[model samples]
Target: MQSVAKIRLADALVKIMEKEGIKYIFGHPGEQILPVYQALRKSSIKHVLMRHEQSAAHAADGYARASLQPSVCIASGGPGALNMTMGVATAYKDSVPLLIITGDVSSNLKGENVFQNIDVNAVFKPITLQSHLIDDPDQGIEIIKKTFQSLKTGKTGPIHLNIPRDILQKEINPSLLDESVEINIKTHWKDINQVKRLLRKSEKPLLLVGAGVLWSHAAGDVKSFAEQHQIPVATTYPARGVIRENHPLSLGLLGTRGTQRANYAGKNSDLILAIGCRLSERTQKGLGNAPIIQVNLDKTVLKGNINIQADVKEFMEKISPTSTKNTEKWLHELQSYNKVHKIRTNYDKTPLKPQMAIKEILDGIGSSILVNDAGSHTTWITLLMEVSEPSSLIFSGGFGPMGYGIPAAIGVSLARPDKNVVVVVGDGGFQMTSQEMATICELGLPIMICLINNQSLGIIRQWQELYYGGAFQVKLENPDFVKLATAYHLKAKMVDSPSEVLAAVENGLKLNKPLLIEIKVDKNEDIPLPK
Candidate 1:
């Protein structure tokens, strides 16, 4: 008979993380999570100490999006856990897979209203796919395995695990750590002949992809399928780089912030094939009343004329190419919209135009992974920047969270040390999580922080200007960002002229360390909306 060795629950959990190949845990330490931290100290996993609990979650979210693997974030109970709600919600909305662990009060203190004790699981239930409370010591390892299983299967998103502090110190069988769970994801395919018949009959067709393509690693397959069928492809914001925006058949982004050509294509297409994306209101804004073929792993989002619930990659591989009519003329007509509605990027103004500044920065950064925050600048970049590589551009698209760029850049930098990371943030969003500069400097990450300083909440101000009578609380009296970056021990520069914008960006990227370039732009500048 083999004897089972005893192991601490926290230690076993750390071992499970190791078994699952988690490299880092982005979090802020607290008393409740001390045991896991202690176990982590002796383990192979590196703990990235974030300045705030929310930033930790954002960092983990960024890491998962960039690496296409499940990432981990840890926080203490109550306030610590509550602060991560926005980040958790952001990940949930975007379908990013993350393992979120929160340390809770002792099991005996339930309902006693102990310090830092709120039902973490209940609070996170709505935001997470699965929120679990590990009350039984015997179920600790099993719960963790289940969490990983949940992260890998179905429509992947963040999963929450609340472990009581006492349970962390409890003993468990070491043999349980060696146990493994195999996830057999069943693939469901629809009738290929019916889909091909739709393709054959349609003269003007558009392929709209979303984040699911990236999550399923179906970029190559999607690109090949589009080319094989001579179809124009447009992607949602999160799925920007899936098909390489520079391709001739690419219609770029499709939505409110999307290109005019892409929107026109969507509004006039005879048939629409939407894959791996929810046709949200924003994505469906300028779309036409075409018969839609929607493919997604989640059956809930399968609301289309013809719905197929299957893995994106498997579906793409199985669907054989068929002949289409008038695609060449359709492609040419769609491409003509680009010339008719071109956004000018050249502006030689005193305080730089946002479009010009954004163009300069994006042009200067060569093949670097771009992570952007929510602002009017997001519109400018989405319009001007071109993405050639899949999963290279990361955005908080669905949740549209402010203060996401800096911390997300940290995660991206950690995940891909060989590639430089650039964070394009507005003055308003930068201030929300500016404290993360210390983390950047401490880690010596190669990140170029492009701060578009319009000195106001640009997007909100635009909305107020358009809808409301005028701007009210949208203006800002900002600090000297150059001095702020310097104080954080990062290389800093300020550029107000259009000619110096590209130079500043080039110099910052060459520094090969944490650098911030503050580009002053016209506060009154507005994002050009599709007419």
Candidate 2:
């Protein structure tokens, strides 16, 4: 290595981050991370001081989801790191790529009950693709580079780096850092002829796009493949915007709160070309016997009837969609089913239904990115919202976190400043991270929050009504949301009836500022899942 000027390890790490185009680092300051804070302050990377460490992680997640790039979040030792576990687990389950950095006790204090010290590496093992404790300051840049490279290689998820305070404060030679290391990923192709033969053989074929398409940036290729083959496409929650939901051959979302049309199409398909998706429980139902051609970046995820372990984009690119077979009859059958399974969204009710409110919101907002929190409202959006482009809709998936929408929307707004960013949340979930409204005010970013003020945990209450004989503890009393927004110096309104929803949403969108529209929905108005 060439001899170069020496700098503090923390500064060297921040320098490498700047080299990699990391514009921001979401985190909280602490005693152990003081060096990191000082280094970041001097460098070009701006650190967002979050209200809580959990929000820091979620912000990183939302940023990565919208930007399609790996994001970084930092936290202090022990309690701070523990606080980040929920957000880390949320990203792990959803397969979002995030780099989590946590401060730790000094190397000399290992296992000595040091203040704010815990087994950070062991705690994050289950939730991260890789977890390491930096014992030597010299290895910091290499480790950071390796972590970043690993996330971009194949199956993407969260990774943890626990840097001891002593190590971060140690001096390191700048020339020792490998700043030019590039991510080299290659997909080993299997036999494509057999997959092609199967595609040609099938009468009714359905292309199931998953989160992998978003990771691989293959939405365009997937769209072209579907259009050329004239195949109906169904998506998982993370893959909602793989294609325009308004496309003629689109089947919207599949599984959980999936559209009746999408579910029906999946059930009837003779062959399923599942690309970049893990055919998990949310997207897979009653398709056990169907011949599945599963394509994924991770080979382990391809455990279907027929599996292809290659880069999703490369695999999709090689597949010829120019099928000579005339499958108009099969396409017609799925399209007919789609028409028959159309959901009713124009109900005129006093205390507005969730579906009706969602319909108006979708109709009112034109081509804007939608972010949703996990709750009964998520089901409504998955079923009702028609998303067309990738990165258009982001939500907590496998983890189903309650407080994700508000902060994640803030992150999304930061990433997608050119597009209008909207968030939908239930009253129960909104309060969990409603404090982020303050974050929005501080940043001065215009975000529209559609709060479904249903006076209970709607999903839990519905389950209790159905199974637990109308059990209790689900009812909630909310502070006047309009007042809540006003306290934060934000524009807010409350809509009481379905008739008033569109006008309220229209007015909020027209404001072009931080606006919250709290729709007072009936507690008893529950949408049972489609049969």
Candidate 3:
């Protein structure tokens, strides 16, 4: 740890981050951050330059998700900070670790009509773990350290920091620097006995995994607990693949656009171990009847939609001893469901059985990161894919924003080059951030792109067909994603029939480079899910 003497605030900022082990900074620089930028240039931290401030935030979010660490993004005042909000909110909703560092107007000019100024703290408060502004030069290190410490404590999310232009450039006076507190404080889970009791008494238990498991790198623990007790795992959109989808214990996603298996598992379960996730309506289908054994870091989140409560890690650590294991009676039932589903899939003749396609991929890939963009594709992909490891599946669950998956996957790839990044995106959704193909190509990140090309905004079209008499305007023929990939100089392939699923899965991941496999599924196909 660098000793903080009364020094330049930017100097203190760099030293504090270095001590916190922050190696990479993602953002675009502006006049407000010039002092910090100059200091950063002299530091070992590598800054990734992005085309847009929002992209920078997404990149930072990606770094955090992929690396499983608090990733940082720096932006200028006003517009830069606002743009950064997109990714900040994404991190907030997804429960990803991110530090959003924004340059603010000078303290004196903050409430005045200064150029490029913003109320960064006020704007980012809701989306952050903590919102702080660096006012005095001497308070820099303590503030930085405290911010990171606060973020790591409970239900960690995005943390925002506003560094004023003038203060960052100011010299700190000696005797004011103090680093007395530890920054790695984490809380204990709530209702340990209650959660364990629920798990123990559950006749049919459902283990719901979210991005928090990934954030905590607790997939191994979750998998062990689920498998040991034969509990079925249901994934949130952002938490797909945390349990290997085909794992007898894994039931894929539940809710409005989920699989029959997932829906049944959740609905029928007597106990729902909603670990590290706030059971949202999209995952719960408005039925919060099952007793939810909620174990999370934040006690405040205990007031969930269901009767769930507590910090998961704390509960598990204390309750694992009290909890009995070696129960596999229910595994037989899950296996029976899997077999029946498979046999029925072979017999069914739908235009495109999304479940079948998903089953194929889940069966084929043992370990890979799956990113699902918003719209109908998000639901379809969730219904199909399974992740055995935490952080393997990524999504914009809260925003449900279209065109978020592809770029996020790109970010994930940058963060986890060792792991394979596979994006399951629809034609319309893919069109939103398809420009990321160039980023993938330039970065040389190997990711498999499963472009479900139905030639329409399938989700809205599904709604329109159901309610609007099939009047389609914006949901018409889509531009060729294959051509788009080709234009980006990335590998491209087309799959028109079910016969192509296996081969595409094989070659797409085999390319060992970025590739787009466009699957033109039947438009009439439906994702059987909870209402």
What's the lDDT for candidate 1?
Answer: 0.88
Judging by lDDT against the true structure, name the best candidate: 1
2 or 3, greater by lDDT: 2
Cα lDDT, all candidates: 0.88, 0.84, 0.72
Superposed Cα deviation of residue 21, candidate 1 (Å): 1.2
Off by over 4 Å in 2: 1-3, 179-188, 286-288, 321-324, 339-344, 347-349
lDDT of 2 by residue, 1-531 (tens): 956678888988888788878888888888887888989878888787778889899999999999999889999998999999989999998889999999988889989997887899999999987899999887677888878787777678898999999999899877767555665554656667888888888888888888889898888888888878788888887898788888888888887667778888788888889988888876776354688888876765677777888878888778855463567898788767755446677777677778888888888888788988988877777766778788898888889889999888877888889989899999999898888888888888789999998889999998898999994999997899999999998888888787688888777777889999989877787876656
Please give the RMSD of candidate 1 to the true structure: 1.9
Give the lDDT of residue 104 in candidate 2. 86
lDDT score for residue 286 of model 3: 28
Q: Write the per-residue lDDT of candidate 3 for residues 426-498, one digit (tens) a residue.
A: 7787776787777778777898888777777766766777789984774556677778899998999887666
Residue 520 lDDT, candidate 3, scale 0-100: 72
Could you tell me the lDDT of residue 209 within candidate 1? 96
